[model samples]
Target: SSRYGEDLGKQDALGNLIRELARTDGIEWVRVMYTYPTHISDSFLDAIAAEPKAVNYLDMPLQHASQNVLKLMKRGGNRKSLERLIERVRERVPGIAVRTTFITGFPGETEEDFQELMSFIKNVEFDRVGVFTYSDEEGTPAYELPNKVPHRTAARRRTALMKEQSRISKRRNRKRIGEVVRVLFEGESKESELLWQGRMETQAPDIDGCVLINDVPEELLPAEGDFVNVEITEAHEYDLIGRIVLV
Candidate 1:
C-alpha cells in the first residue's frame, strides 16, 4: 500500500505515519523499508532527515543497473539517475545507510550488462545488499519476455555478485571499529549464551548485521529493547564485537 501513488492516499500517508511514530516517546527507532526508488519523494526524504528518532537507514531496491534491463523490468531510472538520487539522499541525511537489492540474469542480460552492474556496485558501495537470480512467474510480463537467461547462468551470476558484495560489506564493517555506537539490544547471541546481540543505528532489525555484546559488566547488561552505548572492539565480515560503555 505504501508503494501506491499519492492519488491512492497511501504514499505520503505512510511517510506521515512514520513521522508520527518517530515522535512517540517510546519509539526508539524508526526504520523505513521497501521504498521504491522512482517514487521516493523529497517530503519522505525530509521526514527521514528531520526526525531525530528516525534511523538514518533506507531499504531501496534497485533490482538492476543496466538501462536495458531496467526498461524491461518496467523500473524506471538509469544508473546515472540512481547515482544522483543516492548522492542527494546522502547530502540530505548524512551518515545514511542505504541498503539495496539487485537482480541478475534478467531477460536479454548480457555479460556486458552484468559487468556494468558490478561497476555500479563498486561505485555505490551500499551499506547492505541483496542479490537474486531472475525467476519466472507465470503471470508476470518478464516470464513472457524473449531471450530468457539460462538457469545455470543466473545461479552463477548470483554467486559472483554476492562474492563481490561480501568484500564490500567486510570493508564497510571494519570502519566501525573503535567507535562508540548506540545499540538496541535484541537478545542472547544464537551461537553463545554468554554473548548478547544488538543492532546499531545503521543496522535494521533482522536483515542487517548485529553488534555482539561481550565482556560487559554484570550490572550494565542491557535488557532486550534497551539502547546502550557500546564501544566497538572488533569488526568481522558482517558483525561487530563491542563492550557496554558504562556512561
Candidate 2:
C-alpha cells in the first residue's frame, strides 16, 4: 500500500492496511515513512498506536509554515492548522517520534515568512527535521514567479534552521538517558569498528540517529538484525550510547 493510503468512500485504506500487516506472522516491525500531513487521519494514528508491530514514527513533510508561503507553494494549511494537526498526532499516539521536513526560500517568501518558519521549528520541536532550499525548476509554476530568493539566502536559512533543530534534538535525546528501550542491532558502527550500532524503534534505519553500543555482555553478543533491549547510558545530539541489557 502507498505510504499515505487513499481514503475510499467509507474505508481508510492505509489504517486498515497497517492493522492487517500487524496481524501477519513473522512480521516483527512495520515502519512507515513520508506520510503527508493532510492525509494522516485519526484511524491512521490509531493503527500505529494499537498495533504493536507498527513503529510509532511519522515522517511528514510540511513544506512551509507561513500562510503566504504555503499558499504560494500550493499547500493549503497554515501554521495554526499545522500546530493543531501536530497536537492531534501527539495526543493519538503518545511518544511517537515525529519527523518532518520544511522548505525555505520559496518564491515570494519574505523575511517575515522565514522568521515565522524559524519560530515554528522552535515551537514544534520535532524529533527529526530536514530542511531544503527552494530551487527553481524549469516548467514548474514557481519558476516564473517574481521576487525570487537568491540561492545564497536560501542556503543560509537552511543552515540556521538546522542549527536550531540540532539544539532541540540534543535536548530531546538527553531525556532518553537511563531509559531502557528495544534496539535492532546492526553490527559495527561506521565511526569505529570497535563499537557496535543499533537503532531504537523511534530511529528510522539510516535516516535517523542510532544507539551506539559501548558495552555488551560477553555471553549475550547479538548478531546483526537481532532485537535487544539496551539501557541508554548517554545521549548525544543524534545518537545514544547504550549497553545491552537483554538479548
Candidate 3:
C-alpha cells in the first residue's frame, strides 16, 4: 500500500519486517513490493543489502516524471529529484533491480511534459518499466480538471514511452547474460511442455520476467518448487534462456 511505513512514526518498519521474516525457517526470499519513493530510507536499503535472504529488488512506481503533470495529479516529484533518488538507491544497494511504472497524458500534460518524461526514461536505465495511459474516474479531482488530454493523445504517449522502454528493458536483461544465478523452478512452461520455466531472484513470481529453461541434464532434474542454479546463456526483451547448472 502507498501508506507503507506511515504508521510507527514513519520509521523503517518495512526494513525491520524484512529482517524479522528472514529469520523464519522456510522463508527463503523476502521481496518487497509497491514501496513509495517518498519513504525509501537508507536503513531500508541497508537491510536489503545486508540480508542474504532479502532479494535485491525494489518496486517503486513513479507515476509520472513531469513536475507540472505530477502536481496536477497530486503526485509531486520532478525528473531531477527522482534521478538523485535512484542514484542514491543504487549506491546503497549494489546489483539491485529497480522496477517502476508511469502514467502518460495526465490532465494538463503538455507536449513538453511528455518530452520531459521521455528524457527521464532515457536518463535512468531502470531494470524494468511499465506505462499506462491516464483514465478519469468519477468523483475524482482529475475527472473535473481543466485541459484534460484526449484519449488518442494519451494512448500515443503511452505507446511511445513503452517503445522506448522496450529498448532499455532489453538492454537491462542483456546485462544478465553469462551470470550464474539461482532460480525457483516452476515446472513446464506455458509456451511449451518441453521447455521449463523458473524465476530468478530479480524477477517476481508474476509481476516480472522469468527464466526459460531450454536444456537439462538427463540424469539430474529439478522438481517443481526446487531451487536450482542456472547458467544464463541468452537474454531477450522479457525473458531469459538458461540451462540448469547444478547436479
| Clash count of each predicted structure | 0, 0, 0
Best by lDDT: 2
Per-residue lDDT tens digits for candidate 3, residues 1-247, read 3345666576777788888888889999999899888878887899999999999999999998888988987876788999999999999999999999999878899999999999999999888888989899999899899898899999999999888988888888888899889999999998898899999888987778899999888877889989998999998888999999764
The TM-scores of all predictions, comma-separated, are 0.94, 0.96, 0.96
Better lDDT candidate (1, 2): 2
Model 1 lDDT per residue over 65-163, tens place: 889899988879888999998998888889999999999989999988899899999998998999988889999888899998998998898899889
Model 1 worst lDDT window (10 residues): 1-10
Backbone clashes in model 2, listed as residue pairs: none
Q: All candidates' lDDT scores?
A: 0.86, 0.90, 0.89
The list of candidate 1 runs beyond 4 A from truth reads 1-5, 8-15
Answer with 2 or 3, whichever has the higher lDDT: 2
